[model samples]
Target: MASKYRRGFDITRDSLRVFTREPSLLLLPALSFLAVGSAFAVLAAILFQQGLVESVVTNDLYKYGALFCAIAISSSVATFFNAAVVHCAAQLFEGNSTSVRDGLAAAWRARRQIAVWAVVAATLGTVLYILDEKFGVVGSLTRAVFNLAWALLTYFIVPVIVLDQRRKLRDQLRRSGSLFRETWGESVSATLGVSFIFLLVALPGVALGVAGYFILDGVLAVGALVGGGGIVVTAIVGSQTASAIVRTALYRYATTGEQVGPFDGRDPDTVFPEN
Candidate 1:
């Protein structure tokens, strides 16, 4: 049963294969989300520099409440889109020959449900923020609970909206929670498997990005001025690209039960040779 989240898809072989098959294709959906999410991140940075964050923090009795909420909401939207794209990418990664148009259309089809999920998530996130502010809990404690819930909820929305293709928003969200309990172990492994891949990519990318930026600075005085923004953006895109690929792999491994060993799958849209 699609709802039997316990028979979790095998991420070891198939997950990596998806990214290997179409390295370039993996980045599109994530980039789409990044385009929106990163814009907010950039805007937040600008506002912080302008003392907007400081002023808000100082004036409000619940200084960090709004800040936390905004960040949570932004991250929620980003993750939702990422999940949707992961579904689309999984289809393509499995040799489905689907166009980005079809992939995106599939996601768009579930936009209302996703939007609803995001709203629910945002509300819960805000409530948690309020609780933290009121209680003055440690930051680490707050983060662990928040991220764990987010991780658990990860496959719920994707499975409900994209794979299940349900029309009603409530049905999707409701089904997701139910689905999580069915195969809790497998569902979690799949997420962790993919998350590990993204983390693997992050380490090298950070080193390269930072090293590259400084190298450019050494050669060209005012390198940060001439190309700082572009370099930062490139680093971000690079990390997003890697993260997206791993996510696409996880989706395939989960949905299709296909194992994608390193370099073992067909390139996206590739024509197979006749035996």
Candidate 2:
């Protein structure tokens, strides 16, 4: 029997479905740990920069704007890695009992596509940031328009990354854009739904930090750090998971019912060796 929820969303691969089927249950703890580790690294690096981060935050708003370019590049890399983890979890969900190393290996196997796509995404983001920062004309509106556009148009990326072994990254992007046109409404809604839920969680954490600053300075500060970090990482991971989920749906939809594209003779599974 096909599970009713099966039609709702899938993790990018069958394996990811196992993990993200209960996203908050399995994802939050690991995401928090990873976020904590990454945050400490970032904080330490900033602190060692001779107060560069703090100074920029306080004094130069314009230069601080440039940080988005850096963030955009970093986010591209982070997205690629996020796919890796989601796939690993999906494999386990599929009862494969796969290891995380396999996930990393799968990513390395597709490094060329990964690198090229990341560069593309990062460049687009950096360009947007530059235009916004430098001109301030048609900046926020333009960026927001593109943001909403890209949000809907790029659903095929993950499926292309995992399934279409023959298609290059650029080709897959084109193919997916056209393919998902039929379900464009769901695509937009899902992305916006996740974004709204994220803001709901995040805004409260920020408010708590501000309110607690006076009463319980140290504890609240720590709370803010942990909560803020968790929210950020969860949002990041949630996005990849959602992508994986939708990609899985599309893959199954294509294979079983639709004659949308030729079978690339791929299993759509990430294989790894025993560790």
Candidate 3:
């Protein structure tokens, strides 16, 4: 277990090196957040204008349907941006320079697949939300386990969607599942390593917030809170960027049997040793 953690941490470090070289990759995810938030805002505005907010809130069916629509919109926007990230990252690994515009263009090309996958994602998410709301703790536990499985199973979905010509969602998911089975260790470890490291990194921000509330005064406290919030947000974005890069690297290796860029010196065997 310790060895696995170390390998995962090493992969995260390598991903960070890739990130340092082209920090603009961060812009993609930042844009994703903005895009998703804007999508939800627009959705809310539409609901309000239609005077459906009350019905959505008061009726379970309407509520779930509205939730599904909202989730679908956010999912589509996020998937589009994630496709951009995967496209840009793949280009970087291929020894080619890529820009945000180029990445967005690539995602735009795959917009149909993104739309289909978004509906699938939104459906699953809505079901989980309903289960949690209906059954409490048991539902929450089931949702968590199912969510993790779904995440691992679809780990390579964005890369596949962005790079492959497959139109059907099943075909893309099958490819992703195949790649996950081939490199499950590295994939899981990379996720754990990144999550652990970022959790630790975000702790100081949490501490700052606490200190501001208890030890600091007035404007200083507000400043500390704002600074702390900024740090936390940055950490969240950094973690997302690092994870996407590592995923792209893993996908490239699984598909091409070659690791490039920051992955040049890493031994493939060690990274994905025979089980």
Top candidate on TM-score is: 3
* Residue pairs with backbone overlap in model 1: 5-183, 6-183, 13-259, 13-260, 13-261, 14-259, 14-260, 17-260
Would you give me the overall lDDT of model 3?
0.84
Question: In candidate 1, which residue ranges exceed 4 Å CA deviation?
Answer: 1-13, 19-24, 41-54, 61-69, 76-80, 93-95, 138-143, 167-170, 205-275
- Model 1 global lDDT (CA atoms, 0 to 1): 0.54
Question: Which candidate leads the pack in lDDT?
Answer: 3
- Expressed as tens digits, the lDDT of each residue in 24-97 for candidate 1 is 55555455556666767776787788777776667664455555556556655665556545665556556665
lDDT of 3 by residue, 171-218 (tens): 999999999999887677667778887887789999999989899999
lDDT of 2 by residue, 1-275 (tens): 13312222222233233554344434433543465467557755865676666565665453444454455445555555655654564454355765556666765677777767766776678677667767687887788889778756667665557556434766877766775775455455434444455455567656655655655667667787677666666655555555455455445444453311111232222111111
Ranking the candidates on TM-score from highest down gives 3, 2, 1
* Candidate RMSDs in order: 8.6, 9.0, 3.1
Query: Which regions in candidate 2 have their CA more than 4 angstroms from the true location?
Result: 1-17, 20-69, 89-97, 224-243, 258-275
User: What are the lDDT figures for the candidates, one per model?
Assistant: 0.54, 0.54, 0.84
TM-score of each: 0.62, 0.64, 0.86
C-alpha positional error of residue 49 in candidate 3 after TM-score superposition, expressed in Å: 6.1
Worst 10 residues of 2 by lDDT: 266-275
